[model samples]
Target chain A: MAGVKALVALSFSGAIGLTFLMLGCALEDYGVYWPLFVLLFHAISPLPHFIAKRVTYDSDAASSACRELAYFFTTGIVVSAFGFPVILARVAVIKWGACGLVLAGNAVIFLTIQGFFLVFGRGDDFSWEQW
Target chain B: MAGFLDNFRWPECECIDWSERRNAVASVVAGILFFTGWWIMIDAAVVYPKPEQLNHTFHTCGVFSTLAFFMINAVSNAQVRGDSYETGCLGRTGARVWLFIGFMLMFGSLIASMWILFGAYVTQNTDVYPGLAVFFQNALIFFSTLIYKFGRTEELWT
Candidate 1:
């Protein structure tokens, strides 16, 4: 049941994510920033599932690989969700300062995650060799 | 040997009979209809400028598609839950909330698309009453939700 629920949630979320990407592309002429932000948000939103999968799956090596993937996705999603909206709102409201702050905050989070991964030696398993 | 191993190594899980089949069919149909509706909206938005033409066509298609998808999913979810009324999987408060949110988002997108179409129409045609386009879009969303809530469950149960 949980697996079914997860699959459904992932599919529905993918649809929404696709729509966001399409809309961003369609409206890109208005500004590059909005499209960029939307893309970033979509890129990161699948992190939770990756994390959950890694944490739940058996085998330490597989778990570690999944954890790395999870961290990458989680950071991406959290930063983009928190940052992109504020950037959009800022652009909408014409507040460059707010947008800058949001961008900096996103950068901080991204760097922190990278630093953690590096320090912990959590290597990603997204190599062609695995295939 | 490979075929035998493939068959024998498979894991077993709990299985429901008819309900699982029904759910699978409904999900596929709903997904197709939803994507088709999206394609129609995108096509209309890119080409047509007249609100009346856009409203008439898009609303008809959008409303039908939205209702169809919602009904199918609702029925599928219900079947998955079965007659276990005491457990209330379908009626769970969180599920209901998420369902409502999904409906609202879909409806909201329809309305917004209609509004853009109306704006285009007002720019192109003087004969079309400007307010009518907006009214039609909003009304379609409202009516679709009503039909969805009150419509026969059997229409989607197959």
Candidate 2:
């Protein structure tokens, strides 16, 4: 439960952070900078979570399942955050080819997440046994 | 006070669990926001005077859809109580569908704007009415596929 909460918080915050960063760049007429910042922020945001997951696991405060859940959250945030900048840059520059790539990338992420949830998240409980 | 209670009341909600209630409310809210944002994008794409105006409208729709996605997920998370992976997964699926729909709408708006831009480039004129008509014809076909796919996916709504 704690792990899921952490994941939700992480994902939502990452989305909000990237949205704000894009808004800032849009206001400044910085075409490419927005995507660059998105890439950077996603790369940075996972470090703390990774460390926290490791620490929690080593200390036995959380189970392996919790750690795995944290990892999923971390990865989801990173992928989704990376998406924003790519989409923004393509739209801003009006590069249809690049936009197509962005669209394909988003489709992959969307499908991967959907697949993961469908396969692994179908059980009634997410206790350590499920992991 | 009377109106508030009346608005909150649902004829079939007497035995609904809290989680189900939350999910139902969140779904409706998400759908409403998504549709409203899409409508604005369509209007802006078809009628906006400038490319930048179209961009602004599309961006606004993106922003709103992003917020709606988060809200729906948050409510789903709360409803699942972190125990039922099945419920959580279903909720995520719902969110994904909404995200896809949002993307498609944004894409439609982008295409419309591009059609206008293309017309301007070719003729050095801002008469985009014909271009918009053509764009809409194609857009309807694309949107129909999306709606069809969404309907076929039953995990979330079921």
Candidate 3:
């Protein structure tokens, strides 16, 4: 029941995040959809982590090069996602208001992703690794 | 030259031991810096698309800096120190030479960006954002590579 409730909450947050992303793009005043490219970032952010997990051993060392490289790429992807809208706004390609909306959406969506990882990444019966 | 510089250097201290998270933190910081550099350059490109406004040739600085980034990180500290790497033709000397070339490229690009900023934009009294972007891009990438190279400890964990 607790897991079910958590899933429900996570889904609601994800929906809210998507709603904000859509509003930033589809709103009448903004009408620009370049902010949607952040979705590509969101889709690929977990890829490095997955690849690193598969490549590196679960060692007692503080960190491995593979994991650190993965973290570096993940951070790059995340910052690029935030920077994209700001650059668009700076270049007059998108409105500042739209940029703000997209930034907010990015925050929410990234948080939801993090939450999903935290909740599902446990190495237990209900672990996401099973998938 | 090395002996002269060693005379003025401060003795190394072992007082501060970094936490286990230092590697991850350093990588994240380096990544952020690297991404910011490219993003700033991209903003300039978008804002001023014409060759007259911002010369397309200036982007070579960034391209070289990125190449330097890869070159610098390709050899690990152990490999450079000849601890773990032994089979290569030049061995540790090869790693050191590679690192030296990488550093030279990084510094050369940075200086070139500065020259472009001053010669093309500042002296001409034209718009400076594009020039500033180029300089900042190379500078940030240089620092990012430095951090990624020296900010973490490479230990053989038993």
Candidate 4:
């Protein structure tokens, strides 16, 4: 029962975050959807972690270079996601209000994705998805 | 504030491996370094030049040196581990030689940037940011590359 509630809440929060992103683009005065480019960032954010998980299983080794490289790339991707909206606003391609909205959405969406990974990647019997 | 911070204790984090954190940080630093170099050069391209400003040659050459640094560091440390090998021409010793040439280029670029920085600003008495960009770009890329190369060594040891 609790798991079902958590799933619903997560999905609802995700929807709200996406709504904010769409609102930033579709609002009448700030109708320029160039800020939507951050969606590509959102799509790519989990990719490094996914690739790194495949590169190495949790062995006894203290360090894995491939996993470290993926983590490094993921950090850069996260930085770029935050930087993109600010850059767009700085260059006057997007309004300050829209930039703020998009950044807020990015944070929320990223957090949700992290939560998804945490819940799913937790190595236990109650897997988040059916195998 | 202490109590508030304590409320967010992350004890579970101790279970995770953090040995590679330095390498990861160095890699990100390299990424930032590369980004900054590209940005500075782009800034030079976009910004208007002053009367006595140094032209595009500084940027054009600086990027090549940075490229050399990148290639040098991209090589596996294991490939250049030892100075002796009974094998073919391009064995460990050959890798070392290649590493040597890469370092020379990297340092040469740094020295050249320093010269350009001094020449453009100190000698000519110019104040424009574009004129100064190439020097800073080269310096940043050099430092970042050093951090990356050394970080790779740490990975190899571990």
User: Using Cα atoms with residue i matched to residue i, what is each candidate's TM-score against the true structure?
Assistant: 0.28, 0.28, 0.88, 0.70
Docking category of candidate 3: medium
Question: How many steric overlaps are in each model, in order?
Answer: 0, 0, 0, 0
- TM-score, first chain, each model: 0.35, 0.36, 0.89, 0.87
For every prediction, compared with the true complex, DockQ reads 0.06, 0.02, 0.53, 0.17
Docking quality category of candidate 2 according to DockQ thresholds: incorrect
Q: List the residue pairs that clash in candidate 2.
A: none
Descending-TM-score candidate ranking: 3, 4, 2, 1
Stretches of candidate 2 off by over 4 Å are: A1-94, B1-126, B129-158
Q: Model 1, clash count?
A: 0
> Once superposed on the true structure, which residue ranges of model 1 sit more than 4 Å away at CA?
A1-41, A44-131, B1-33, B77-82, B85-158
Docking class of 4: incorrect
Model 3 chain A, poorest ten-residue lDDT window? A122-131
Candidate 2, A12-130: lDDT as tens digits: 64455445454444444443343434455335544644564445634422233233334434544544454454445434552434434434434444444444444445453554354
CA lDDT of every candidate: 0.45, 0.43, 0.89, 0.72
Give the alpha carbon lDDT tens digit for every residue of B38-154 in model 1.
433443443445655544454553554355435433532453335436555445554556566656665665666566456655567754433343444444444434433333243
Cα deviation at B17, candidate 4, in Å, is: 8.0
The digit string of per-residue lDDT tens for model 4 on B56-110 reads 5667657777677757876667677753345576787677888888888888888
Say which candidate scores most in TM-score. Answer: 3
| lDDT (C-alpha) at residue B58 in model 4 | 68
